[model samples]
Target: MSTLAPPRPSPRTTASAGLRGPARLVVRQHRRAFQLLILLTALTAAGLVAVALWAGHDADVFARTGCRVDTVTTDACTRSTRAYDDSQYRLNHSLSVVALLTAVLSAAYGAFMAGPALARELESGTHRLAWTQSVSPARWLTAKLAVPAALTVACTLVLTTVCTWFSTRGTLHPLYWHDTSVYGTTGVYPFAQALCGLALGTLAGLLLRRAFAAMALAAAAQGIAVHVLQNVRGHLWPVVHGPYALARSNPFPRDAWMTEVGYLTGTGERLPMGTCFPIRGKFGDCLDSLGVTRRYADYHPKSHYWPLQLVESGILLAVAALAVYAAHRLLRRLHA
Candidate 1:
């Protein structure tokens, strides 16, 4: 009798050969979702790069005319200048929107975690079967969160790095770095937002055990968290202030985030923007009557971008950690 050699794993199994135990099992269940996620992400990132390259070519064509790209003065400028500016605007706007969509999807990972990942199992009692097969509640929960979280971070990293690179190197337009949609997608901050969504979704699923309800709750919560963070981000770091003399002038760079613009009182107190608006009589007389000394402006300079990103990311991560802990405790109470 011929001796049989060891069997070879199938190609599908071989591709995922390294994954074992709960990790592999989780992947098997959500393979379709993962496939769809990766496909969409790849297409979006490709579009971003393509747009950037097209913009670069347009910029070069416009510059060759020896026309000042910034000012539209009639210097025998060809129609190419207007066309170039229009193209740049469209491309940059597309870049911002697509990158923002990717970030939003990362945050929507919570809905997956809340519905199909956790609540589905709990609602249908599938988790009980896993628990009987040498898997505790904690192990089961970890498997659900860890695999998806890893995928979220991986997808986010690729898209964000591409966006950041395009924003810095590819964009020749006058787009500001701190545009809300653009900022939300560009750094470690989006990664933090993803984690926060995942944890909150987990918590919601654990509490509700109903897929639809849990998903809705998690998504709404994530949206609120994102909005709250974005709203408060400027205040996270002290802004660079412009002197009263520069009030009527923008001393900050064109790309800086202007947090405030107003007038300064003689006693050095800041006044609102319309302090002398509608200019009754002489502008100087109105200023003198109101004790307005000069103009005041507050802005976060370009250099402060990274610091703002880092600080907000830290705060979000802390919130995510607490949410995870609370989820674990609740699961333990329910099971034990």
Candidate 2:
């Protein structure tokens, strides 16, 4: 008896079969997370565009009113400055909120990575089934991390680029280059921070293997990282010390980060500016009485902005690398 040859698989079926691996499984399992990531990216892009357009409109108004001239006392100048400052305040506030939201979402992503993506599978014994199939445990973990890591980095880079563009606009209202929120969002720092979060989450997942515990630990780790980094950010670059008069022209170059201003004693010691507090008579007289020979400041010049950002980014990336390495080692040990 001649058995009918089995029908050949269709091209679509063949293609789907070829895709039946760890990578596709990871995508299918976390499809909702990926969908949310796309939505978040679109919203962030739209918000940034809206802010840019609004700032551009305000800038146009400032230009039409001829408020570019340096005038501190004219009624027109005062009105113009007020309008400009108001617009700036709104822009900065909005940007700050967006930056904060980005940070929060990044941290939440870390927690999700730990809880839902990794630990849940381990907890439910689903990972064992995946391992027994065509996927090895290491490959399964790699696929899980590779997808989210790629998406996170791509989205963060886009957001950072948009933020950098917003920062370059010459609106009457200017954001300080050293402002924490501004700096965090406008450079490579955001990308590093997001990657760090992802690595920390993965490590947490491997360690705890319990969804809630991993999520909580990952979130806490992210919070501690942000707090510590913020506290030490000023020291990431060398501080330039100089006569404070250099600051008097504009308090600082528009882009310089003025960290501290103080009195320089005749003996060459630095005293808090508070020593000259409550300037009563001549400011110099008050300083002389305090044995101050000159005014001084500790600052990071505008030129140091990139250096500072690079330093911070490097530190964060190093931490992320360590976390990832530790996760890999832990996985190997567990499976050994």
Candidate 3:
């Protein structure tokens, strides 16, 4: 007896039966999460900009600086005073607002971005839909991954630009001392490094396989490490090589650095504090004090900004990438 030949799938039938391509699937999968993130980001950005404009020239970024001027060095005091007096407080205040929004955005994205997609896929077995389709598991993951990474990079670049502009004003001294964001010159703390934080958060989500858990891990890890490292690198480590040295002979340590004011102690007569006077070092080491006869002197520390940021961000991002790779491998192996 003759057997009937098996029917082959027609292009139309195949197309109708098959799953959509990876790109479309990725979008479909993450549409809700993306919408929420976009809404949150837009609202945050608008609020910050509005507040900055409304509060224009009235913010107190410089008020604290003015208070410290009398006892600090000339340039530091003068710059701080002029910054306050010039009514340029808007720029510095704007930065603080921007920094806050950036941090919140990073944390929000980190907490939910990867977890929403990955955890549900694993738990619901919907991942099998794509896994059995034309799309490789790798491509499926890549498309989903690319969206948040792109969003994070764009946001971070914008924040960094704003931070640099705000930092140039010299009025946000206390904010910098406290916040310590790696995004700008003054702020320390690893969490201040928005790009690194976002990337690490994504990786954390992948590793923990739970949205809230991953977010908490990312926030705590980045927040604590960045804060601690910022201080150590800025104050203790020679991460940024300033133009001037902190040698004892330099007579303008306080003027050079308000932070160094307490460290000032003259070898000779405790030259009346707050007066610029000549100090005799050695035969040819004569230097005039800019109201400082002892303690460490400094030049502009702005130059050190890029290098330290590079190192700190680099390290955090590297760790994040590794974590993500490990998680991906583990998931693949478990599936196998």
Candidate order by TM-score, decreasing, is 1, 2, 3
Q: Which ten residues in a row have the lowest lDDT in candidate 1?
A: 14-23
Residue 44, candidate 1: C-alpha displacement in angstroms = 0.8
lDDT of 2 by residue, 1-336 (tens): 899999999989965564457778778888898888888878877887887787678767877887654666678877877777777777777778778977897688789889999999889988888877756677778888888888888888888888877666645557778876688788788988888889899999999999999999999999899889888888888898877542254455667777887777778888887875578677777776778766787888878888888888898889889998999899999996
How many clashing residue pairs are found in candidate 1? 1
| Pairs of colliding residues, candidate 3 | 73-255, 180-187, 180-188, 181-187, 181-188, 189-226, 189-227, 190-226
| Per-candidate TM-score against the hidden true structure | 0.88, 0.85, 0.60
Top of the candidates by lDDT: 1
> Which candidate achieves the best TM-score against the true structure?
1
Against the correct fold, how does model 1 do in TM-score? Answer: 0.88
Error of 2 at 281 (Å): 5.8
How many Å off is the CA of 87 in candidate 3?
7.7
In order, candidate lDDTs are 0.83, 0.81, 0.54
What is the Å distance of residue 219 in model 3 from its true position?
3.3
Per-residue CA lDDT of model 1 for 234-314, tens digit only, reads 899999888757335565678888889888887998878876778867877878888887787789888998999999999
Instruction: State how far residue 172 of model 3 sits from its true place (Å).
Output: 10
